[model samples]
Target: MINYLYQEQNWKTQLSDLITDPKELLQQLELSTDQLLSGAILASEQFKLRVPRAFVAKMNVGDALDPLLLQVLPHHLELEDHPEFVTDPLGEKEANQLPGVLHKYQSRFLLTLTGACAVHCRYCFRRHFPYQENLPKNNDWDNIRDYIEQNPQINEIILSGGDPLTLTNAKLELWIKRLESVPQVKFLRIHTRVPIVTPSRIDDEFITLLKNCRLQCIVVVHSNHAKELDPYTIDQLKNLTKHQITVLNQAVFLKGVNDCAEILADLSYRLFEANVMPYYLHVLDKVKGAQHFDLDSAQINQIYTELLAKLPGYLVPKLVREIAGEKNKTPLYGETF
Candidate 1:
């Protein structure tokens, strides 16, 4: 459970009051700074540390190997150069057609509303993404709409960013209204981590906006460990399901964080408990700074094979890898019944 004091504060206040300093995070967890702090500080120089206090509260004290902590903690390994790990691993630069628009697939169009996020995962594929150059301005909406209108095959619009929920309800509504204007767009999919990291972001206003929207709304939340799904966060996710909104989860198969089959199975069950479906278990994207989190194919296949045996078919998320320029996410796991 989250602290009662934290629960009382507004989501924006919580967002603004994140733990950015590496020393403070280590101190708060009562872990020694001697062995960890230097590497953490160095790595964080590239991709600054950002994690909510509420999210930090979920991590076990005095344990450096805590799964939730591993997901956010900066490490010295991130600075090492890997040949295959490039800055733009997904080739998003080429796909970036217009400001804030990424036309990756034939049917789905992605819009980056804001580059702000509540929590900064250590293995984020977009750590080096040039968000400032790509963010869509209010004036740029017309161009985005024009592109969507011209692309007749586009039936879905994805709301992604540092995390779209980081934006205010009014701002989200503004873009959503524009998407609603497009007669061809039938689905509005939001890929966000705010609901898991800062559950308070899912307030009544946002819920109402999603519930009343003309387009079929799907909110896909990112969570790697089951421990991140506290009672408070679970209740917030349940609020979406109660209103007939579709909720799904996509987790990265990080090496140290959630590499075990039992942990993956537990996450599936926890998501199910909140009425959220397990969607995609993505293999780590070969981003330059995130190479440390990548697992060998044999390790990935072995864990996933065990995972398949443990969970029901519906609960087992499809193991996939997002190859650059590929038409769809490539499924990595072999056939299972």
Candidate 2:
């Protein structure tokens, strides 16, 4: 288990600066302490890795109170104790028939464009995913296209990976063009944290590409805490809306993060304020190394009920957990006090 005291002191000293430039960040990451502990450290554990210099400069370093760092830095993950935690928590790779394509649930096909993430989230279920084995090939599109073609009822195509937005605009546009060729596809959702972690990812060119797409573009952002959204992030979100993209946020319930009634409620309100609808408050996925962050189902139900009581119906996000083989996200309600 990670001692909060040690985490705070260590994080304070280690993440002295934030950097966002991908190339420079990659260089620093190459030398990151986290790399040395990759297979060794549990996902919940705290270790000092170099934050992107650009991302760090945005933090209120003097305050020693940065939400960005909390998401990325490794804390003391209880690897020895968390025997139940497995390497593949969401059963992601097993759904893959071809590289980059995951046909898990009905009506939805997930394209793993790239395995690079701007921020390494502590609670990410896919942290241990084997990306090298799944790199998309030029002809992989035909395979994915065929899968979607076989399932005419499938209307949604989800672009997810380390973050699909990690792909260059040209590459993403090519993928979008191919998906658009499918007549049955109506919804194109891009699940990403890139814009939140590095708001610059949402430049005008990126917004324009989605705007031009035929399918209804839905950008599902992952932001756990309200503090993660600042004026710059709001501006980036605004750009998405300006292009008529529907912006939604899905937050994972983490232990030290936004686990409280007030914190979660405020997050919903803030996302609304930024023109993004608060969609789902996910119970932490049962991924190994992330067990420490899981809130019990009973506790999650209590929080969900309290949120309903506090916020208006529309602002309250649904509390749910994903169960493999289940057709839908199991809504956690009517169970706890």
List CA RMSD, all candidates. Answer: 1.8, 7.6
lDDT (Cα, tens digit) per residue for candidate 2, span 39-80: 324432332243434344444443322555555655556354
Candidate 1 lDDT, 200-293, residue by residue in tens: 8899999999988999999999989899999889999999999999999999999989999999999999999999999999999999999889
Q: What is the C-alpha lDDT of each candidate?
A: 0.92, 0.72
What's the true lDDT of residue 113 in model 2? 88
User: Which residue segments of model 1 deviate by more than 4 Å?
Assistant: 335-337
**Superposition TM-score, candidate 2 onto the true structure:** 0.83
Per-prediction TM-score:
0.98, 0.83
Ten-residue segment with the worst summed lDDT in candidate 1?
Answer: 328-337
